[model samples]
Target: MDIRQLKYFVAIVDAGSLSKAAQKLYIAQPSLSQQMAALEDELETQLLLRSARGVKPTTAGHALYQRARAILRQMEQLRADVREDGGSESGMVAVGLPTTIAAVLAVPLFEHVRKHFPGIRLQIFESMSGYISEMLPDGRLDLAILFRDSETHGMSVIPAFDEELYVFGHAGLKLRKTATTCPLSALAGVPLVTPGTVNNLRLLIERTFLREEVELHIVGDIDSLPALMAIAHGGSACTILPASAMLHRAENARPPMRRIVAPDMSRPASVCWSHALPVSAAALAVRKAMVGLIGQLHADGRWPGITLRPPPDAATLEDTSGSV
Candidate 1:
């Protein structure tokens, strides 16, 4: 019915109990319940189903919960814009990164915001690319670094870079120390641990292997990057991922890494934001900062195994300016 009621409803849904929501909102439980009742009355529909266990949103409540979150985000962005107009950019900007990319970029991005955009608060979510992809379109994340194959309808996607996949494992693995690359056929019988099929990187690996007529002996499915690396380092199974995934470790301590070749495989990373939502000044600033940081990292060779994609405008200009 109103913004306050919507907020209360969302809190209730998230907390799953009136008492819990009341505690979170710092209001009385009865007051919260009354607000919910008023909201349901105004809408002429039951929003939530109550029970001894807890509460769950009805179908309409689920729908309103999604729209309420987006509306709340917009309202916050409106406030941020007003503050930006007063000469300082200040607001929360949520950015999502896949686990592997987070290993290389998270801290640098956090420090960059702290130094350059003092008033802007950075909320970075590091998870599976699949999860991050789900958040970006619903206003839960202002921006995200997602793979090219991600579901991206109604979103503006900018190519960031292409990173080559590599085979990594402990010294006990069958990999040759003298070789810098491993042929796709070499891994046909190798025990491997990889992210599940839902992950873009995993999907890419699967498609590549299938097309090349190579069979993969996937021993385990690990969505967590750290756990996958640990399994590989312990000689449980070799894992395939970009070199950037190991950037957090000391160079000397890194596991054996060999680029996948004989038809090298790579995945394109893209910066994405919802086209339906109005991006705030703070979000825009963070996006620029992230792009510039990626460029610098690539230029300095700090982030390796990646070829930066040129800006869309540059690509367009080159296309139109080609010699006849």
Candidate 2:
């Protein structure tokens, strides 16, 4: 019925419960429930079905949720456009990052945006790449930098770079390192602590190993980056990740890392956003800043172990110019 109610409705649906959404929105549960009730009363329809597990959107609620997201996005865009007409890019842009790369890009990206587009607010969501991909269609995220298995789902994909995987563990681990690289066959008996199958990186590693006839020993399945790094740092198991991850780890203390070779494995990283949703000027500015920072990082050898890839189309150049 109102923009505030629509926002509350969308947040509730995304969080899957009134309590959780209330906490996320920093509002009291009773207040959130009252708002939803008022919204339902105004709309003259049942919007949610309550269950022991959580609340789910009813048929009507589901339709409203989708439209509400679009409405909210457009409203935010309108605000940004007004600011842009005043010669300022000022709005919130949600960026999604994979756990592994979050450590690598989070700070630098923030610093870049702050210096270049002080009027724009950047909200970074760190999660598994699969989860980040889900946020695009739901309107929870305006832009995302993540790994791709060649699927865009009608969204625009701007290739950021290609990152080579590596075997990383404690310094005491017996690794056959030659020129800072190790053969994949050497990992037959090596214990690996990796992300769960829900992660795109994990799936890529599995598929590559299967194709190359290498036996990958799975010692742990961790979805948390800190936990995975702790396991590797404690000499429990080696982790297979991109060079940027190792670079992040090495910042605290240099750990043993060797590039995976003998049929090298790498994954493509890209910036993606939903094509169906209109891109706000704020989101576009943030996107360009991100791409430029990544390019600068790769060119300066700051983002180690990744090869910079060209954008799939010329739109990147067009959108980037004068965006910041």
Give stretches of model 1 more than 4 Å off: 12-23, 27-34, 46-59, 83-88, 149-151, 170-174, 251-253, 314-324
| lDDT digits (tens) for residues 1-324 of candidate 1 | 789998898888878898999999999998888889999998999999999999998989887886887788778766876767853667888999998888888999999999988889899999999989877765568789999834346777768899899999843345568888998888887888989989888898889999999987888899988888777777768999999888887765567889999999899998778754556667777877778889998888889999998855644212211111
The lDDT for every candidate, in the order shown, is 0.82, 0.79
| Candidate 2 weakest ten by summed lDDT | 315-324
Tens-digit lDDT track for model 2 on 1-324? 788999999999998999999999999999999999999998899999999999998999987876788788778767776867853677788899987778778999999889888888899999888899788766678788878625456576678888888877743345554448888887776788888888888899889889988887887888877777777777768888876675555465545778889988899888887654567667877887788888887778788888888644555544432111
Clashing residue pair totals per candidate (backbone < 3 A): 0, 0
**After aligning candidate 1 to the native by TM-score, how far in Å is the CA of 62 from where it should be?**
4.5
